[model samples]
Target: MAEDRRKEIVRHLSEDDLDRLLAETDDDKISKRLTFVKRLYKGATLEDAADDVGRSSGTATRWARRWNEGGLGLLTPNFGGGRPPKLDEDEQDELIERLRDGQPWKSQEVQHLLSEKFDAEYHPHYLGTFLRDLGLSYAKPRPKRPHQPENPDEILEERVDDALDEDDQPHNKRAGDDGEGWVVDEDVCTDGGTVIGFFDASQPQPYDNSRRVWYVDDPHVERPLVKTEDSAVGFYAPNGESLVTFTEDETKERICEVLELIREQNPGKRILLVLDKHGSHIYEYTRKRAHQLGIDLIFLPSGSPHLNPIEKVWDYLKWTMCPIIVENEGEFKILVKDVFERITRRISYAQSWCEKFLDLQKLS
Candidate 1:
């Protein structure tokens, strides 16, 4: 037969044979043996295979010789057995202590430190495994905060009381109709000074949504002469051809003017006016005058602008006026007039936008 009558005995090696080979040979030597086996399977002579695979003919012949003698067991590796660690228990404890104290040390850092300090050349990965075997793990230290005073309970109690007091206060209450009625909305105008003036009306509704539940059937309807501005003092309403400005004014003239407008608009009907809790709006004179005009001035809760419908109207005006550019005061006024005209004409569209706003608030 042709030697062992097999063209490629390399293919017939079992898993156990391969394991033995790997166990018997180091990684570098096994690599050389694998190359030789490949060449031999490809029909190269033993001598040629040895030379081609960078092994001596004698080593190649020895591998072939072993194969014929005892099958594939000759290729396997054997790990020599050892009793125990050479280092004492105290030494291991010292090593662990040294490692723990010297950290901020990565495995590679520890390995480098070992080589530099103790003339030990350890692979980084092996060092990691060794540390893990010794029950050492990487961990981050907790950060410390500044020391606080011990009597924080008093301060906390005071804060809680203040919060509760604020919560207990009445918020945006709807104004009762006191014979002087007005609509709260924005008005756009072509005034000679600014392109647009925001006319905000402060009239009280029968019920406040901030304080109680109150809904309008036609909340989106554009009541005439309502003008809002993002830049102006407040919303405005038409005072004849000119616009009347509403602000948080304490003066009697402004308060009287507002009262007069409400009485004029609603006639004999009691007027409800919702107003902010500004010092000016809360003056005794303003309140007395409003009472005299049959107007009930309901004060809006502090710091809640969203409760006011006039604020929403102003927002709409700003949205509408964003695209219009005014070169001068005249152009600005014209643009404002045009915007108001468009808004007035497209009443349904304005209504839809307002409805959408309400819907979004609901969803939120």
Candidate 2:
């Protein structure tokens, strides 16, 4: 019965496909086993199937065992074809050295090299897989840099405490002084395009001053000219009614004017003037004037433009008075003057803005 089953399986095979399978000598036994298994599935007895396929009873039993265990797949042959690698240990080392020396051996380059040097035709993709199997990969070359000092973990807390202590100390300390002195704040406007207006937090009523207290008082208040290439019209306000243009010479004059006003107002009081670090404000003439008037001038650190209160006032003016257009210089002057009048009336708002700015600086 098994021999009959095996013959039936062989009869079902396509002649052309069977002939192709027979062409691979190594796969013949596996193909014969597949024919036996097919016959067994069709209900032939094991012994008859074995005889019909010219196999011994033991061979038929083995094929039956494989079919019962794994079905038709057990009778199929695996075809893994390719030549063994030609590049051995020494060749691998040479390839790595060439790559390390900055020679480009990309898959295409390697393929070209193989054809030229070893007379082997290789696909670029195949060569790439070969290189990958050898633990090689395409990567960017990185340059090395000098080592830096390592952070000392144990001293981190102590270093941080020292920094905090240094920051807490007063910036300027007098000899043998234990108490921290006060820091006065002052703002200097350097751009002079037009006279807008000014707000003095130090004065409750800046408009009530006999002399013009802001940019609005300047004779050239109406002309909307650019003070400097970097500035727009009315960029800096020096006095309550004066828009002083930004110039080394003009800055010196404004500083002198502020010093004069401080001197005139507080005849006996020693004043500390805090100003932005503009070159003209720190010039010899300005310094001498401050010294002569018994004014101590302290400047804000460089690049800290927002530290100056005048900048805040300028921002307010720009927001409230921008888009202010005039047909003539006189008309422009009148508009600017009106803006100052409005600012003078809004002293409370000015004070609120100034206080908020100072609070922000403290937090920063």
Candidate 3:
């Protein structure tokens, strides 16, 4: 260890040069080596720099010597490949973008793409690692509904944008803006302004809802089972406000109760409830009540439950209560109440209904 090493405490690669190398590198080993050299340049003893990077003093000393002699080239490890990568960094990134074009590409498909496009051949086995490095993975792709709307996001965004835009203009006779199917109630404000809510219903048993849980050994529970025709009506606002009440059944009259509940929550504002085309939801009784209460019911295209964000809330509730077992209806009611309080309706829930809808809407 030579004591008279550096006159200035910080002098290596000019800070700008070191930073540019650090910024450009994706290899952790090279990053660590550069960091060790950085500490040395900043007047740290070899031992201290080694400790900082979790390397031994001997390792640090070697890195410093290598960098001083050969710069980053010697500091960086060698891949030992006889030839340069067939796909350079930019080309690799471009390939990743193409692979992510909403197709569930199998390894063979990707391999064929590589061969055809880049004139590079990769074995199916080698492709797993290659794809992972490019931030891709093998997993079951989620299925899309056959009847899912091609432009649900554009449709929703336009509806919301137009509703909001109406406030700026004089409220005229609002008609034929969204076509006939768009109008569930003919009486509400056709001009503008609406607070959106996603509405849905689910039937859960009194006994238990189950999902896979972590366990070392197989687990079992001696649980009592009871079946009841109890349904829960839920209104989930994107800003995390939600109202869920147990109902006897999702009948037309019961749907009216939910409309009134939503109106009560929104007060002076108009309510636009997005829900599936359940028979009870679109029934004349529900429509009339919604119009009377200053609410508009937007019927999702038939068989399209995916359009309503509230369904995720119900799925999450069931997932969280999966292990919980309530012996009687009383206990089950208590459980539901306690769990509901904890369900933080993240603003993300609403954003999921809007912001992310466009990107996912076009998926086939």
Candidate 4:
């Protein structure tokens, strides 16, 4: 640090440049730079100039160095600007047009698209600045996908209340306790009676039922798809015991059949069916038929599949069983039947799933 080597602005701005600096209304950064120079020209120290222009001493020093090296010309917006953009004006216009055509693009995805299509590569950090300059801001992610039910936390809380009241359970109960029993109405029967059951519709596809799979790190290993002539819709509990029925189409009539089957299975008492509010389940014809038989339907809260214990069963079936039973449609049906029997026989599995929701009532 030599005392005699103090840096200063060596050239004065022309009258026109001074006028433009004062009159210019855009580009705050450029305005700050001009103000720093103007303050320094008024015999202010670098520190004083920085304070007057609301910039740091380092910024003032850089502005002085640029002005000293290239006179007033260096103060222009383009002077010593970093690298030129990869996308030209025309290319940028095309990119904006493509983006406006209604598709969401993550920054990395956009980077890849530009690299592959336009042969333009950008540092990930610069991409943020580029997007901000283009007048784009980060958007909050959607809460649910299309056709998904819109429910508030209070709605789920209400369902828990209703479920607890229906079962006549006390408000306080431990979550992991074995006391969560599917008790039938005592007045209905003494030795045997109709049972509570969860029900949902599922389709077993040949491909991986989930987005993920157990595989070696190989991008080229394509996922296999079983191109069946028709799809099969299964009506049963998600993770519990139910009288499952298969149909080519999941219709109001098919759901009514399921209800009748449930009623027939438990002949002595009225069957209590816990199911989602699917259109088929709530149709006029389906409800009337259910009422005629000794079948009671309890619809779960909208958009709250988590509240349904049987959701776990569908997850187990698709991710665990569907992957292996891929020989043909016949084999798939056989696999479903085998798994269904095993699930129904092992009552503890379904009970454990049911217990979770039972304890949800006790949750604060």
| Strongest candidate by TM-score | 3
Q: Residue 210 in candidate 3 has what lDDT?
A: 51
Judge candidate 2 at residue 193 and give its lDDT. Answer: 22
What tens-digit string does per-residue lDDT give for candidate 3 at 179-263? 2332334434433344667888887554343555566776664456755567878887653246777888888988888777776
Backbone clash count, each prediction separately:
33, 26, 1, 3
- Best-to-worst order by TM-score is 3, 4, 2, 1
Pairing residues by index, what is the TM-score of model 2? 0.29
lDDT ranking, high to low: 3, 4, 2, 1
Best by lDDT: 3
- The 0-to-1 C-alpha lDDT of every candidate, in the order given, reads 0.46, 0.46, 0.65, 0.60
Work out the TM-score per prediction.
0.29, 0.29, 0.51, 0.45
Each model's RMSD to truth, in Å?
A: 26.1, 25.3, 12.9, 15.1
Candidate 1 regions with alpha-carbon error over 4 angstroms: 1-252, 327-364
Better of 2 and 3 by lDDT: 3
Q: Lowest summed-lDDT stretch of 10 residues in model 2?
A: 199-208
Native-referenced Cα lDDT, model 4: 0.60
Expressed as tens digits, the lDDT of each residue in 67-112 for candidate 4 is 7777656654563478776875457656665665745778888888
